[model samples]
Target chain A: MAFLKLESLRKAYGEFVAVKECSLSIGEGEFVCLLGPSGCGKTTTLQMIAGFVEPTEGRIILNGADITRLGPSKRGLGIVFQSYALFPHMTVAANVAFGLEMRAIAKRERRERVAHMLDLVRLDGFADRYPRQLSGGQRQRVALARALVIEPSVLLLDEPMGALDALLREEMQIELRALQKRLGITTIMVTHDQVEAMSLADRVVLLNNGSVEQVAEPFAMYEHPSGRFASTFLGKSNVLAGDVSGASVLVGDQELPADLAGMSGAVDYIIRPEKITFAAAGGLVRGQVTARVFLGDRWLYQLDTPVGPMQVIDTNVGLPKAVEGDAVGLVWAAENARVVARGAAS
Target chain B: MSRTPIALHIFHWLFVLFMVAPLAVVVLVSFTDKGYISFPFDGASLRWFQAIWNQKSFIDSFWLSLALGATAATLAVVLAVPAAMAIAWHRFPARDLALALLMSPLMLPAIVLGIAILRLLSHLGMTGSLAGLVAAHMVVVLPYVLRLVIAAAAGYDHALSQAARSLGASAWAAFRRIELPQLVPGIAGGWIIAFVTSFDELTMSIFVSSAGTTTLPVRMYNYIANTIDPLLAAISTVLIALTLVLMIVLDRLFGLDRILGGKA
Candidate 1:
């Protein structure tokens, strides 16, 4: 058994289901991200595991203990809310000391632990300042220290860096990841940002509506998405509608090379835009550039291909100089295009 | 400094003087020797203050009113704090309607509230009791407590409670440690405002007070029905001074501007 397991969790309110039959197993000291768009029940799942929201049907097992029915305070999971939720009235030391104080730790011991935790978060000199006196990033560090002071079993983050400015958010992402790695804590973060998820998680569980869509290693999920939504939502992908025929797939009268293993019948698949390269004359396919965008590191071209509208991205080293209305030859590795199942948004 | 508009400057001072003139006349008349309403008098004395201080009925009723105001304001705080917490912190069906009902007394005429309380108390045969007076006074002051505390709670980030709970504090502990401290300013403001409201209330006291339970406001009204005396002016001056002291206390504690929802 894993260190933490969500066994077939389900939550519903009257006629509407918020999370349906969601199950996951997390190993010790592994970082996982619940990645999805809004209303995907990611936050709800994290809340249920934290014991803030009770699961209507399922068990949350932590270290072989059935804690699904426990209260949040009893579950002893550290949660960093998006708001950073530091108490305004209490100084930094008091806010961090509250949990220790609640456990009836002696005043001297509580003070020592608070100072140690503050130093851990690099806030040694801010012990006497109120939360309102700290900057956004400092306040977040205080919130982190407050949660970590209790030595909780799991650290749950609900869009932990959502409130910071863009530059500060990026900086905190690196700092937070470093801190999480150093602690080796069993951590789960909920985020809609694919980059943040891919950069932080050992595994990303993609959710759609009230159900799990795909869960895999971040790169594996991106490289070989299990469904159309995962393929498109995780990163840009050109989905080609094709019918598998014998050893090849037929795509709009053009039988592009493909690895036709067990997949058969009508299929929809994704080819990553960066995987496609400029082919020689009489290439695997022909396309005309309909639109183009210049990113700092790469150039994106929206091409009108025989299969459908396709996107191709090429690095800007020496600048590809692909212009609109230019005809281009495109080819990709046969195994690079991955077949995925069609799934509904709902 | 490009001189602010002359018309705007004139309006500002005129507004200030308009507000100050009534209170100024009361203080000046309270010092007069004429024993009646006196402004620009030939001579002045503190004889009326001495007269008010020596009068046993006024002195006794003054203490009665003080105790009633404090008791009623305390009760209102006890009732309003939790109610304001519930109303401000959670979203339920008809929440606005519930708040409106809680504050309906503020919209009702004082005479109406007085008569209604009188009828209810008389039916229960508890009329003219100190408890009845405190109960009537609670109705007059509850709205202030609700409005002030609700405004304070409005600025609160409820996620603080969740963070507290996650950090191993029980629900009660979370509220005690995280919420109560932040709410002190509003509670103090509410108590002071309610105390002043109850101290100045007269319409309900007239209907409820018997001779034994007569409040200072009722005694002053009864006294004024026959005599024109500086004793009345002296009493009014004392009440005004008491209100100023309370305002100063509130300013020192929570800043009066914050009670009115200003960024102090």
Candidate 2:
């Protein structure tokens, strides 16, 4: 059985729905990320799971027990916030000892546990220091230590690295993932950043407008998105509109073999930018390079074709360079494209 | 910038002199060795200070004011913090109306409130009592405490409380651990201002004080009415010194800017 199951969980504020009938089952020790843009209900769903928000409908089953109506305190869950909400007046040791104090642990044990938590977060000597004295990253670590010290059943992180700078954010993402792995805690994170989701989550749940668009492993979500929103949101893609004819697709005046089955009259075909290559001789479609942008390791070229403008990414590998307004042939393997139904665009 | 105009300079000096001249006169008269008040150059002595110390009534009234002010300020804070938190966090029906009602005392004239309380206390047969005075003072001081605490609560990061709740803290525990500590500066500031307001209050005390229950301000007013002695000057000097000390203490506890302007 899955460790945590959210069955048709719905959260609404007045007439506005923040999260629709969403159901997800996460196995024990799985690190899942709810990834979406702002107002996409990822945070709302996370809050519902954390018990900070009461879902308007549906049940929350954790370890086969219904906890839908349980208060946040009664539900044993640890949460790290975006702002790293460490108690400003308390010392690092006192802040870490708070959870144990609430649990009514013995003084000596609480002291030892606090010390151990401080050491775990690599702030052993800074136990007596106030939170204001610590840097953003150190404060974040303190928050992590404070939450993890509680030894709760599930861990929830809401945009945990959102407040850090770019370099520090990336560093903390790696550190957080490593820490979660070491602890083997069932973790769920809500993040709008796709890169962070891809780097940390075992599975990413893509949400759009209060509904789940797709839920899959990072690679699968990126390579084979079920909808336009999912494909575009997971990573960069070149989307082209076309009509399918048997095993081929008609794009304006050019007819190309369809990569996948079940594509109907009108469909949106998604191809990763990196998949398209420049061909000199025989190719699927002939086009002219309209624009070229050098992006350090690679060159991003926009090709004007019979269908539309197709974006292609190429590594700067000493190939005969294609300049702007230069005639070029664009080609990709038949298996590189994934056709999604047009109705799923929204 | 060009040199300030001569007329503007004179006006600036006039304004400064207007502000400082009365205080300067009080200080000079306080040190006068003569039996009565005088201005400018005075033969300075500690004789008036000794005379003021000789009176037991002034000393008793001073302590009484201090005790009442302290008690009222403490009571105000105890009442205001939770009210402020409730006002900040939840939106109950008529919340704004309730806030406006609680704050109405601030806009009302102090003498009117004092007279109204006196009439009510007389009806209840509780007039001329210490409890009555403290209760009346609480009414006046409550708005300041509530205003500061509300500002503090409003300024608090709601996410912090949510984070605490999500981390297994009960609602009360989360507020006690996360929200309350952050509000300490504002609460302290509110307490100080309330104490000072009650301590220096004169108009309200005039209407409410009985013979033995007269506060320092009422006693001071009566003393000044009867005699223009340097003894009164000495008392005024002491009050000024007390106010300065209280302000310094408040500044140390919670920055003066925060207390005066409701900025945390």
Q: Who wins the DockQ comparison? A: 1
Question: Which ranges of candidate 2 are over 4 A from the true structure?
Answer: B1-19, B248-264
Q: Can you tell me the DockQ of model 2?
A: 0.69
Task: Put down candidate 2 lDDT per residue, B90-194, tens digits, no spaces.
Answer: 999999998998898899998898899999999989889999899999989999999989988887888778767766678888878888888987887889889
Q: In candidate 2, list every pair of residues with a backbone clash.
A: none
Instruction: Give the alpha carbon lDDT tens digit for every residue of A1-346 in model 1.
Output: 5999999999998898999879999999999999999999999999899887889999999999999999988988888999999888789999899888878899999999999999988999999999999999999999899888888889999998888898998898898888889999999999999999999999999999889998999989998788678888899998887788777778889887777678788787678999998764666789899999889899999999888999999999985767889888998988998864444332
Stretches of candidate 1 above 4 Å error?
Answer: A344-346, B1-5, B91-97, B262-264
Per-residue accuracy of model 2 over A39-97 as CA lDDT, tens digit each: 99998998898887899999999999999999888888988988887877789898888
Please write out the lDDT profile of model 1 over residues B104-137, one tens digit for every residue: 9999999998899999999999988988999999
Name the top TM-score candidate. 1
User: Which candidate tops lDDT?
Assistant: 1
